[model samples]
Target chain A: MTGNFFYFLTFLTLFAAIGVVVSKNPVYSVLFMILTFFALTGHYILLNAQFLAAVNFIVYMGAIMVLFLFVIMFLNMREDTEQHKPVLSKIAAAIAGGILFVVMIAALKDVNTQMTTTAVFDSQIGMVENLGKVLFRDYLLPFELASVLFLAAMAGAVMLGKREPGEQNRF
Target chain B: MSSASNAYFTNVFIMNDIPEVIRTIPLNYYLYFSTALFCIGIIGVLTRRNAIIIFMCIELMLNSVNLLLTAFSSYRSDPNGQIFVFFIMAVAAAEVAVGLAIIVMIYRNVRSTDINILNKLKW
Candidate 1:
């Protein structure tokens, strides 16, 4: 039953992902991406990462996607304005993606599916309590650094988004 | 092996109580799933001219990697990878903030979201 559920979730995720890329309207694309994120959250749940699942929901679907939609609506571009990349470049992109996939598979071919003998695999690693301990104890520095990155990004975004009367043509 | 012993062996000893399905799924499956998703994002990024859609593709790519990392971390019994995944999410959030701000600024100035319109940096 769980295996069947896993396959079902995978199918949903892939379908939504393709919709995100293939949709003609930007609005539809954003909606599809939201669906993909939701499916990914379900995948996280299946992996027993409950904390990450919630984070995926809030940060991804709630904040980032809402921001994307705001920008899309704010831009208010026409629905018919579909810019097509040249046919040659489109083919090149697909080829490049396929080649990359093939290369990665080949490179990882030798590594097989023997269960890791490292510490026993714990589903509880996804629990907030366990993860909080590791995050604070072992990864304290990187965790703090992430906050600094957020500060810098926030400041930069504010600076960039600021409007000035005489700075019409300034980049 | 008796069914009871098999369950005990998988749960308490080998898996440390993770779901049986997750334990049974091959690592190769995770790799394939994530790589295919990542490649799709790559193609989207390459083909899409709209900056917002391009950024969405980037987020898609980031997510594929996130999924891969978490899958590996779970099966490898390494919690550090999950921590990294958290950080990646933070960085992604920051990226979306700054990226959208830039996009908004560009749209304000050029009145178009099309990349071709912004050929000159001096404008």
Candidate 2:
């Protein structure tokens, strides 16, 4: 039953991810991406990483994707009129992408050693308590650094979004 | 030959008794699946011209990494990877905040979200 569940969740994730790539309309793509994230959250739950699953839903599905939708709606451009990349560029991108995929697969062909073994944790381990303990102990510096980086990004976004007084007439 | 066959049977029996399917599959399968998803995301980001779709692809890639990290954490019997996944989530949130704000500002100027037109910085 669990195997079937994993297969189902994986199918949804892969399907939505493909939709994200193939959808021409930005709104549709964002919606599909949200579905993909939700399916991934399901996978995280199945993996017993309950906290990660919740965070995945809250952060990606709730906040980030809504921001994306707002930007799309605010632009309010005609989807049919949106300019696409040149045909040559598109072909080049495809070739480059294909080559990269081939190289990556070939690189992983020989290294077959297993990096980890199955060791299920206690239920409490994936809860907030264990996560907080480790975050505050072993990962303290990195966690703090992430917060500082977020602050910097916020300041940068404000600076970038701010318009000059005289620049309004140029547009 | 007979002794080796007996050992293989024992290993198979041990695997069959794992109560949870998550405990049975090799960790490499999860890692490889996530890697493929990440690769797909990368391809999407490179091939798509729409700014919003590009952002979505970036998000996809990040989620792939999160999946791999969580799987590794579970396999190793450690919660550190899960904690790291939390930090990654926070960073992704910040990224979306700043990325969309800039996209909105760009749209205000050009009236379009197509990335090919935003070549003002080209010298």
Candidate 3:
């Protein structure tokens, strides 16, 4: 049952991910990405990482994707008129993607046999209490650093979004 | 072939009698699937021409990594992976903010989001 569930979720996740890449409309791409995130969240839940699944929804679907949709709506991008790139580029991309997939599969071939029997960890470990302990102990510095980066990114976004002084005509 | 069947039957017995193994299988499978998804995302970013699409592809890639991290944390009897995932989430949020701001600026200046058209930096 678990194997079948995972197989279904994996297929959905892959399909949505591919849709994000192939969709012509930016809005559709973002929407498909949201679908991908939803499937990923299901995978997380199946993994017994319930907290991560909730965070995945809150962060990706609730925050980032909504922002993407707003941006797409705000921009109102017209359809592309330029001829699609040559067929060679598309073929090359397919080949490159195929090669990458093959390489990753080859790298994991050794581990496949060893991993046939799944190893179970304590469920309590994935709960909020345990997560908090590690976050405050070992990973605190990087956590703080990430916050500082966010602050800087916020300031940079504001600066970038605002029009420069003396750049526009005054009424 | 008998050995394989024995292992399968043994696993079935263990899974039925011991639920822990059943739970673990899903996590392992998710980790493997997420890794594959991440590879696809990398390929998309490397090959795509539309700047907006490229940015979306990067998001796809980031999410894939996040999935793997989440799975590993659950598998290792440690929540550190989850915490790390939180940090990654924060970073992804900030990245989108800055990335979209830049994209907006580019659109204003070039009136197009085609990456190939932005050749001013080309020597």
Candidate 4:
């Protein structure tokens, strides 16, 4: 029952991911990305990383996606605004991505057999208490550094997003 | 094709040992799925000319990496991998904020979101 749901979720996730890539309208792309993130959250829960699942939903879908949509609306990019890439680059990009995928798959094909299936785990690693313990005790420095990074990002965003003196809204 | 994936599908089901059930689904499945998604993101990045969509593709790539980390975290029973995932998420959030800000600033200056328009910096 769970396996079936996993496959189903995978299908939806992959499909929505493609939608995000293919949709011409920026708004649709943003909406499709929300769907993709939602599916990813489900995958996180399946992996038993429940805390990350909620964080994924709140951060990616709630905060990041909303910012994307706001930018799209603020910029006022109309429908049919997508530009046509040169024909050669379009074909080349597809070929390059396909080749990379094939090569990596061939290299990693033995991974499943190579992974030792011997050890069993608690499967509760996703619980917040365990995550907090590991993060605070061992990874505390990076955790704090991430906060500094967030501050820098916030400052940079405010600075860049600010309007110059005498600049119009352009809306 | 689809048959290959379907062949690996199992009937096992459990809510308690969800990890075991998920584990039994084979490590290759997660690895391949993430790889495929990552490649799709690459294609979008390479092919699309829209700045926001390209940014979205970068997010896709970040997500694919996150999925891979979580998969390995579970397969190895290492909370460290998940910890790394949090760092990646934090970095990704920071990246999007600054990246989209740049994209918006570019759009404001040029009145267009096409990546090609930023070629004024060409030497």
lDDT of each: 0.83, 0.75, 0.74, 0.84
Give DockQ per model, in order.
0.53, 0.43, 0.44, 0.48
Q: Model 3, which residues run further than 4 Å from truth?
A: A81-83, A112-120, A169-171, B1-28
Kindly report which residue stretches of model 1 are placed more than 4 angstroms away from their true locations once superposed. Answer: A167-171, B1-16, B119-123
Residue A1 error, candidate 2, Å? 1.3
Best by lDDT: 4
Q: Could you tell me the TM-score of candidate 2?
A: 0.84
Interface RMSD of each: 2.7, 3.9, 4.2, 3.9
lDDT of 1 at A22: 81
What C-alpha root-mean-square deviation, in Å, does candidate 4 show against the real structure? 4.1
**After best superposition, candidate 4 residue A116: deviation in angstroms?**
4.2
Each prediction's total of clashing residue pairs, residues at least 3 apart in sequence or on different chains, is 0, 0, 0, 0
Q: Give the residue spans of candidate 4 off by over 4 A.
A: A112-120, B1-20, B121-123
User: Once model 4 is optimally superposed onto the true structure by TM-score, how far is the C-alpha of residue B73 displaced, in angstroms?
Assistant: 0.2
TM-score of only chain B in every candidate structure = 0.83, 0.81, 0.75, 0.82
Candidate 3 CAPRI grade: acceptable
What tens digits encode model 4's per-residue C-alpha lDDT throughout A1-171?
667878988899889988987787888989999999999999998888988998899899999999999999988876678777888988999999999999999989975433344244457887899999999999999999999999999999999989999998676
